[model samples]
Target: MAVTQQEIENRLWDAADELRVAMPEAQYSSVIFPLMFWKYLSDTWEHNHQTFLKENEALGLSAEEAHEVEYSTYQTFKIPFIHPGTVAERRASWSSILATVTQPGLGQRVRASLQAIETANPDKFSRLFGSMAWASEEVLSGEVLAAVMQAMDRTPKMHEGNMSHDVLGGAYEYLLKRFSDGSGTRAGQFFTPREVVELLVEILEPKSFESVYDPTCGSGGMLIASASLLKAHGGRGYTLKLYGQEAVPDTAGVARMNLFMHNLTQFKVEVGDTLKDPRFTKSDGSVKQFDVILANPPYSLKWKPWSNDPRALGGIAPQSSADWAFVQHMIASMDPKKGRAGVVLPHGVLFRGQEASIRRRVVNDDLLEAVISLPPNLFYNTSIPTVILVFRAPGTKVPDRQDGVLFVDASKNFIKAKNRNIITDANVSDIVAACHLKMDAGDESADPTEANSLSSRFVPTTEIAANEYDLNIGRYIKQAAAEQEDLGTLIDAYNIARAERQKTEQRMNALLAAAGIEGFDE
Candidate 1:
């Protein structure tokens, strides 16, 4: 009996939802997910230990012979079976055990195992785990914690070679979705709606063996999408390297547990301010470049002391909004050799002259790839319209594309769901297809009116330069073509409005007459 993806997702969400009854959505993610991850690891630990012992004994090896295999096989932080200290041996001392486990001195041992997982599971292992505040007396004393633990124990078992990664991954995604739905605007910070994520990944088409990175990887959804995209394209034989930087430790730890559950132990997601303190620096203390960069960074976040840092490659993102800073960082991290990137940005970033220098530099340098306007309500936080900007180094994968940028006016492309706009598979395909034709100048298709068709055209550098490098999609994509508009639509709208106005006027006249007051329309 195999667990379906839908089943796993629902079960995981149910568990998280139960815990939510006792705590805030945000607070309980820290509490419930770590407990769930712990249960998963413990189950995996027991299962592996039994298998390792059996295999070794059949080969005539002593019980000790299987210890290394037992401890070193999976890409998760290996918790010592016997507590290194008395605290681990007593269930009553769970709090103290957690304290000892997370202490700086003892934490090093955990980090060692983490590093090993990072090396072994490049796609899944690079996140922080067992680093939350779970051992606190508050979590230990609550019945909710007991419920959470029980829920976790019942969670289906998963492993590197087993169904755990996908099972737990689905659960994790479901929980994030539930959080976003419940917390509203606050949850928006870390969540890029799943449909939007799917669209981004579809357009980006991350390949196997390529390194993908997200500077603000909240909850690892984008990273997970990247991995999933590659896996879908083909099995994960190709080396996929993931690098992410997050400012929040708890969020970073959640990302780690996410990767661990998904069996992606090889990624390196660091916790630090991406702009102020970039943790992805190389040995020479410079930014390391990657093949593909996809990010939905906090839109228009501000940072103080607006003075320029040389690290700000795209020019300084305004202190009022760190959007440009993230842009610069993404550009910096991209390897000019084969670098490409796509970013979700506020519509303001397309034409706002407040950061003229940054915009000018990016467009003038011809790194601007494509700008696709998305429908409003696509995000949980804001109702403002958004866009995706694609970039590629000159003479890279698409050489002809280096001189021009693609503009896609997809603002009208979406499926309306209850309270939000969603980018369906069709929308994703439209956007991705438009992007793939990077060399075509705004005329990728002969007919723009065809449904399910991608209408994209390249914008010449000369035109871009003429507009002073404005990246607005409306500036390029012909939203309404000659045949798109019709006399029927115009006549119908005029007739309907005229009829409504006439009725309103007549009703108003009657009301005035009844009140013995005359009203005149000039």
Candidate 2:
């Protein structure tokens, strides 16, 4: 039977359930993702081996030679085993591991298999499984490990015939969501909510064959969103070259796994602090820029990388808040001709005092194109309101609204989810439409109210300069007043308060009379 997305999810969730007793929810991915990926590779290898044997048999090729050639030709990832040896010696695949669940030292065997796979594919899979301490009997008992492995084995077989890359990738994303939800703030280190990702990607509009980059690409969601956006626009998403730099090694591995699961091959995810040691550079050792940059970096991060290697433009961001430092890096990393970026940052970056100089310089350079304030509590890690700052390359052509920065007060546009708020499809579409129209208009002198139905307006550079280059959306877009219908309720409350005050006054007069204070009584 063909495997469906729902079935894949059900199997994955069941496997996750088995791990609940053995480990914390956050640690589940360390064991589950690697094992799931291993099974996928093994299943794919087996399928290719059968196909190659059938096709090459007519060409007088032996089964072993056919298997070898097929392995080299068809597999997206190579799973190493004792080739040309007895079947028992080649017992390193996922199927073999599943068969040995009842055996002693199951955790050690699993760890060894993972190590062997990493050894065989160093560039792609080195330390990819991360540190799985739970894979030890001291941490997770053998019985629990056996039960988890059995549950994973029962999952519907994942192979090309039954599952396409889209379905499998979707399942992988679903698992990522589940893990992030269960892990809470720690999950924010690697995952950005999908709705925000979609909004940024839509506004940036990455094209086919263009390079897209994210400096703090938690779990590679932003990069994947760009690819998915391209695919949605009738372009080949795989053709785009994706680049990402993550500060955490485990998060970087998760990002690489994310891209691989989505069948994205043309990508690089390096482990390093983007501020201190940028991994992507050109032949000249200068920062390599991308056509489209999307990032939701750690908000208000404090770092001193500038003291070691200062960026060329925009003075050093204060050590107290590295928000402007990241902005400078992004601006410097933009393609000189057509580079564009959409970065999510805390509201403080818009009007904070410490970052005034950097903000002024960036604004004077005309790189900042728009500021869209997002709803508060949209993130798992923090309830602070955030904003998306859109920037274009210095020399890039500004269409209609080039005279000033577009301010969008979309802070009220979100659906209340169980815990975190979400920007719905309509909200995303509305924001994107407003930005496009305002940019095309390019008329800061035009009536702000005429710009859009939403509370979006174009604030001229002159006004921004007068206001000390503050990009706070609220400074420009006025909040709507109370509705006429609400006035009735307000009037009723006022009348009730007056009646209570009158009654209190009468009682006070009575008390004054009883106390023989006639002069005080009205």
Candidate 3:
């Protein structure tokens, strides 16, 4: 019987629930995702293996011959075709390991099965399981592991025949969202809010067969969204090339699994610090460019800045914040001919003094196309207001609006939720429409910036330059006057003032210590 996507999602979450007593909910993703992926691989291989055997029964082929034929013709990765001759000692089939679940040292046997499968498919599954050192008797009891397996087993067969990739992929994404919600703020490093992702992908407008990249891809959500958007528009999603680099190994593994579950094979997700060691590069030893770039990088991360790196487009960003550094990398990676990029970052990138030179350079060069300020408290991590910066490669900008940037103030378009705010479908449509609006009003006499648009502005470059290149949305898209003495407003004001005061006090103490005056701090 066919099963619903929600049923599978519930079963998977139930399997994760079995581990609650074993570990904190925060670490559930690490355990649940790997087990789910292994089960998927095993189930898919077994289902296909059975069909291969049935179809070739009339050929009078030996087990070895059938195995060889089926693998060459049907499989993308290696899983043992049958309980075999020379490879008998390393029984890595899911059933083989599952049968021994009640036996002593089940953890070791489970580990062996995962290791063997990974070894057999080195190129596709190398370190794809992430860190499996936790799958031992010491860290996890065999009973708990078996319970998780059993709970997952209750779900409908995960093979391609029984479950569509859409069902399987939807379930996987459902689990990802659940994990992100359960894990709290740390989830920010691995997941971006889907609505935000939708907005960015819509703005970039990726096409069929175009290359899309996410330098700090968390669970590869943005890359997946690009393909999904094309598919939704009746384009061939599989033709679009997907690429990503993640700093964490486990996070990268999750991304790889996500792409596979989505049935995407034409993709590469490498693990490395993108700023320091970008994995995708050309033979000329330069960073490979892409047709579309999307990223929601770590906010205000402190990192070692390299002055000599050519990606440092507008001088080096201070070590205090790598916001501009990430922007520079994406801009450098944009295809010079037909590239467009969108990034989600704090509003600081728009007006921070440290990144002012980059703002000036990017503005003067006409790379920046628009700024859309989003509501505060929309992200799982920091609650500070964020904005989406859209940049188009030179010569790709709109002919009439190339001399200005569109600024959108969407800070009030979110629906209040219990934990965080949400951008509703209507809100997204309004924002996207505002962004893709006709820059030319069709009347040459009427100024494009004087359209009196609601919560939006088409500010000319000369006007921006007059304001010292400040692209803060407030500078152009002025807000309506309102009372600022409400409790929420006062609290937000106090937080901002307190944070700024702390920074000033810390700097003052540092200066006093440098001058050999210690008591000044008191």
Q: Is candidate 1 or candidate 2 better by TM-score?
A: 2
Estimate, for each residue in 1-522, the C-alpha lDDT of model 1 and write its tens digit.
676777766666666766666666766676667656655665565566667766666676556655555656631344433333664342211222233442333333323433343444455434445353554444443355445544554556654435656666777777777777777776777889988887877777777778889999988888888888778877582367888888887788788777766767668888888878888778998888888888998888878633756666556666688787788888888887878888998877876666667877777788887777788898888888888888776556366576777777676678788878888877777677766653555454434476634456787778877877556655565552332443234545887899999999899888888998875653
- Which tens-of-lDDT digit does each residue in 188-281 have in candidate 2? 6677899999999999999999999999987899999999989998988988999999988777878888888898989998889998889999
Write one digit per residue (lDDT tens) for candidate 3, span 409-491. 77778888877899987778888888877765211111235332237668888889998877766556435123122323344
Question: Per-residue lDDT for 171 in model 2?
Answer: 91
By lDDT, the candidates rank as 3, 2, 1
User: TM-scores of the models, in the given order?
Assistant: 0.78, 0.86, 0.90
Clash totals for all candidate models: 20, 2, 0
- Candidates 1 and 3, the one with greater TM-score: 3
Where is model 3 more than 4 Å wrong at Cα? 81-90, 440-454, 480-522
Query: In lDDT terms, how accurate is model 3?
Result: 0.83
Query: Which 10 consecutive residues of model 2 have the lowest summed lDDT?
Result: 480-489
Note the Cα lDDT for every prediction shown.
0.68, 0.80, 0.83
The TM-score of candidate 2 is 0.86
Lowest lDDT sum, 10 consecutive residues, model 1, at 90-99
